[model samples]
Target: MSAPHGINPNIPHSARVYDYWLGGKDNFEADRRVAEQTMAAVPGIRESARNNRAFLGRAVRHLSRLGVRQFLDLGTGIPSQGNTHEVAQAEAPESRVVYVDNDPIVMAHARALLTSTPEGRTAYLEADVREPRTILEHPDTLATLDFTQPIALVMVAILMHISDADDPEGLVKAYAQALPAGSYLVLSHLTLDLIDKRTADDYVAATSSQAMHRTPRTGERISRYFDGFDLLEPGLVAVSKWRETPLFPDEPAWMYAGVGRKR
Candidate 1:
């Protein structure tokens, strides 16, 4: 079957692979192959994906309860249950959300499924995360979000794609500088901290053929991304342990997650 316009189903996309990990039916064979390979390498990867998603929901809900009604979700993946707008708007009907991603498939799926409440609004931006200014200046972003008010900047499990040379910290700081005080930065990243060198090498070998540009950073480095933000309770920890206590505490931490508000 031919893929949709502007989409090459033959080439695996990170977002689609992620959708496969989340058990969503929006992925193609290429994506499933990579996802399955990753699962084979890191047996706990699928569970870790679910945990990261749960962290997203928890962070958004926490910010909403704290009265943040606007959201700028960068690297917005394939829409599934508990999307940012869905979770935020459910808490406050007047919430406004701007979903941004560079992938055509992600934008298409988001536009079709990430609907907004009549009282709230949702806009999709076909943009890359590396260019924070482009995203902040996009007309769709300006139309959907208020720069003056607090906005939650959500970047989940996407930074690993950014190479170290790209200065991921500087990219994050650019966005942080643009956001108003009181805005929240909700971020989660893949890490190799709690696992052995062999396991990390195995994971890299499994996905290396997929042309994925991933860099799993240390928890300390990931925490530095939150520079000026005041981290909420239970500061940066395994995604499974962020706010939600884990049933299996012995599992190796595959990802680090946290929520912080600009100070």
Candidate 2:
């Protein structure tokens, strides 16, 4: 498919690659190629994406049932089925969602498809997660979300793009500090725990070529991101196992997922 204007279709973006894995047609040739490389490196990578998406749905639905009307989704990949808005608004039609992403293409697709119900609202911010200030201070974000009310800060399958130099933990703290008590933090991150070193290296190398740094963190490190927040039941576990019966219970987990509320 032809890329939207101002986007380079020649380069593979992690978001587009993820869309491809989810069986979406919003990816380019480069994205498909890199996605194939990662799949070859780890055959279950596709299932990993599916599991992450499922975790997102369950988390949002649970939050909505708990009366969370505001959601600030960071690093929202290419919009697909069961998006934050879809799941939240499905449960609560008054849900207000603000999706943030660095990829121009992802934002473009979001603008076209990530609409909210008439009782709710949805806004898009083309910003990097590293720039918490940009996302938190953006006019659209401010207009759509109220800092006083509880908001769900979603970081699904996105933190891996952040390098250690960026202090991913500190970054999460920066955003968390802005949230008031009772706010929720939903996070999911990639891990190399289940894959061989050679496969992990190969997958990382291919994604890195497109400036997609897939830094796999240990469960301890991933849990650190939820510091200062009270973990929900089941705490941190495999994305597929987060409050859901895993379809492949015996298979190793490729991503760690959790939900916590500000104390």
Candidate 3:
């Protein structure tokens, strides 16, 4: 209906703010204002966003190396460095990637930067992660990915926005059920597990807007989101620890990243 809705620049979107934190040029002043406030509350907020982006590339490379050639990346913010298709296709030139997002601005930019290698494919769909059916049943998703084979369902730095009212667990289950046995669920979520309450509250207040509602969960609660799957080595830890090839150590992001396989 009316293409859902157009971009609202007055209100800060979490994705755009995250883009700002990542030093991208696609974000507006409203996003930058909130991002600066979040940084004031939690100084490591920018680092957290950077580490999460790095974790996505590492996880995608690992999965692609393990032979996953298809991907469904949800809540894909404005395309930045080390995007899903780039990382996956780096490991295997024939990788097929499908990106899903609700932001019109992201969709427009996704159309530009989410390209693929000659042997690979990359496509974007403007859809919300809360609606698993629409993403799973979309013609592009069905056509680009083969359910009979293994695929990586990437949910990086996005689930925390799903409030308790939405039954996030049930929604995740629906997506997991649609995948084959060997498919992987790669997710990184914002958490209050390691951060102080003051920082958490202030950070939420600074960033929460009409476009985004913050809900930072605990380590235990975030683990429950992986109930039906078998977690990989080292399990769910900080995003910075998700199988990266060693870099100079950095502060904890207070976010958890994990890769789980549908068993």
Q: Model 1, which residues run further than 4 Å from truth? A: 245-250
lDDT tens digits, residue span 38-123, model 2: 78767688888888888999999999999999999999998888999999988989999999998888888899998889999999
lDDT of model 2 at position 63: 95
Q: lDDT of candidate 2 vs native?
A: 0.89
Alpha-carbon lDDT of model 1: 0.88
- Models 1 onward score TM values of 0.95, 0.94, 0.93
Q: Write the per-residue lDDT of candidate 1 for residues 38-100, one digit (tens) a residue.
A: 888886888888888888999999999999999999899999889999999989999999998
- Give the per-residue lDDT digits (tens) of candidate 3, residues 214-245: 77888898888788789998799988887854
Candidate topping TM-score: 1
Ten contiguous residues with the weakest lDDT in model 1? 244-253
Each model's lDDT comes to 0.88, 0.89, 0.84
**RMSD to the native, candidate 1?**
1.6
Cα TM-score of candidate 3 = 0.93
Listed per model in order, the count of residue pairs whose N, CA or C atoms clash below 3 Å is 0, 0, 0
Q: What is the clash tally of candidate 1? A: 0
Which residues of candidate 3, in runs, are more than 4 Å off? Answer: 1-5, 201-211, 245-252
